[model samples]
Target: MSTSLGRGLACSALAIAAASTAPAEVPRVATDIAPVHGLAARVMDGLGTPDLVVTPGASPHEYAMRPSEARALQEADAVFWIGAELEPWLEESIGALATDARVVELLDVEGITTLEFREGATFEGHDHEHGDDAGHDHDHDAGDHPGHEDEAEGDHAHAEDDHADGDHGSDHAEGAAHVESQGDGAHADHAVDEDHDHAGHSHEGIDPHAWLDPGNAGIWLDVIAEELSALDPENAQTYRDNAAAGREEIAAAVADVEETLSAAGGVGFVVFHDAYHYFENRFGISAAGAISLSDASDPSPARIEEVQETIRDLGVACIYSEPQFSQSLVATVSDGTEARAAVIDPLGFELETGPGFYPALIRSIGESIAGCASS
Candidate 1:
């Protein structure tokens, strides 16, 4: 409902117009992440150029703004960040910037359904292990808390219990068979517990990687168009026009991706990280599991074992890594699972030019998934 554009934003647009016609003070726009940068690039077509400071191949997990990036943010006519929670690193820098700069938090904008982190999910298992056991208390005394346990039991009955099935089968299996099956499921459960431990901690719960979903790209485009129109009323039509065109192209790319992925046979694959949930959600492609949760943290032996078990259990069709991350981790995970390692650029780690880059990026992921499937 906060419809007012930030202060000096329209003035900056005037400056851009004036700069083109007379002077040369085009409004500088800074985007926090790659998807925003891509959408903004489309909105900025034929208008003034916007400065995208975060280069391709950089992960938002730990993007420290460099001197050059800081300078770009400080000098921008409009500043765009996903949200405070998603990009904590950018917060202090954004707060330090001049008030006159139009600080637009895109997630806060109307009509955007921000992805909520899976309610009780955490990045701790993927990032690092911690002893903060206060948040995720998974224990309850069956005697003292009979009522709560009964409720939990009811809930378990309503929702299919995967563990219960495994446990039931384990009861009848012989020694080695029981041990092997139980061990595999136990390893998977431990990994799940590790992930669950950081439930309440606020560090971007739902995957902030919405750009991976091409349908979500349409949502971002609408926001960009509205923001650009507000900033430059005179040339608003151009911004809207470009955004519409961009969306159509992205939709086509999305269609191609779906077709390719559908034909790829199984949705099973492995990724360097769990950042591709939106992609999976969009195309129904199931990454067997992530090699590691964070690019910042190397996978522990136990964690690697869980990933390997998932690959084996799911009959993973391929293993894909990102150009943004080092190939070593992917190679190791692939080697352990005997899955082929292929590089997929989610953040456009490589330079992509022209207006069609958005579609090209989407199609590239589809191609990568399909190619790895056939191989």
Candidate 2:
């Protein structure tokens, strides 16, 4: 009887040892854009790679999902997105696919800060208020907000349709086959209805570009680790450890960017077709005025001349430009002034994608502004 009992205890010990050495399971994760992917990738660094939905060089505002992207959503255990405000197009598809996946809307992640869109070519007032959910309030509570049903609709609650991205129905029509498969009255069908309405909607709500802020990036890392942990408890500790490392990495980058931009001294004004205030606000710099008018629109010839005059008067260190607007016009505005036209991309379109991408993107913005301002 003593030997039998001893044998049983020995078998139990071996079983326990085997379980301890088994490989940990990680969730199959999917993320919306490069920055979000980079953050999520940090948490799942050794466990697995999170799939990115919005590939680089592609416009999130008016993107059409490919078949592989749809497959990634359908098979994913979790999906991370910036929320409807940034990729208003992906809403419906997420709802239709990614059915069982846990979707983490980073914008709605508790403690994440949001900024409202700055209107006009020249953001006149240059308001720096952080709204609950940017300028456009979305319930993401789907159904009634047929307006928010334009894009992907996987696992997100979706809320009210953000009229902010009015409609880019045409851009999705030619190649959105995967999206077109989402049943009879899917959002893709509605998008086709707004073929020419892209210019019709005024994008006044929240600026969904929250990832630009390294502080926000750090906040996102913790939440990402938490959610991924819940889905894959076996790797919870690894996820947490990765997040801690990511936060430290982000802190280090923020300090470096601060050091670089400490002397920028404001280039008098910033002309942004899209918004860069998240970066500006993070670094304690602000644009005095915009190159547009009261609303966020292209300036009339008179408005352009007025901006040029201001550039001349201030001898603005540099006049910034984005691809959304005309380069020729920017050159004309800087023609007689000492202000040099410098391009600053908010999307980090040129940066490599990976765990290090977010920090690199943040530093690049600081370098661009500081370099241009000083030169």
Best TM-score among the predictions, by candidate number: 2
What would the per-residue lDDT of candidate 1 be over residues 1-375, giving only the tens digit for each residue? 233665467778998988888633335677776556767777667666555545556555445444445556656667766665555556666666524576766544433333434321112223321112212222323332111111110000000001111112322223211122222221111122334322122424445665666655665565556666666667777867776777777767777777887787775677776667666656655555677654445566777777777776666767788775568766666665657778777666563643555677777778888898888
RMSD of 2: 9.9
**Candidate with best lDDT:** 2
lDDT of 2 by residue, 1-375 (tens): 699999999999999999999976678787887778888888787777778776565556655665556667766788889887666667777776677888878776554557776654454456565434445333444321111222211111001111111122333333443354443221221222211323223355666778876667776777677788777778888987887788777777788888888776566655644557787767777764455431124556776776776666666667777654457767777787777767776666677766777777777778888888888
C-alpha displacement of 102 in model 1, angstroms? 2.2
Name the regions of candidate 1 deviating beyond 4 angstroms. 1-26, 113-204
Model 2 bad stretches (over 4 Å): 1-21, 130-202, 288-310, 323-326
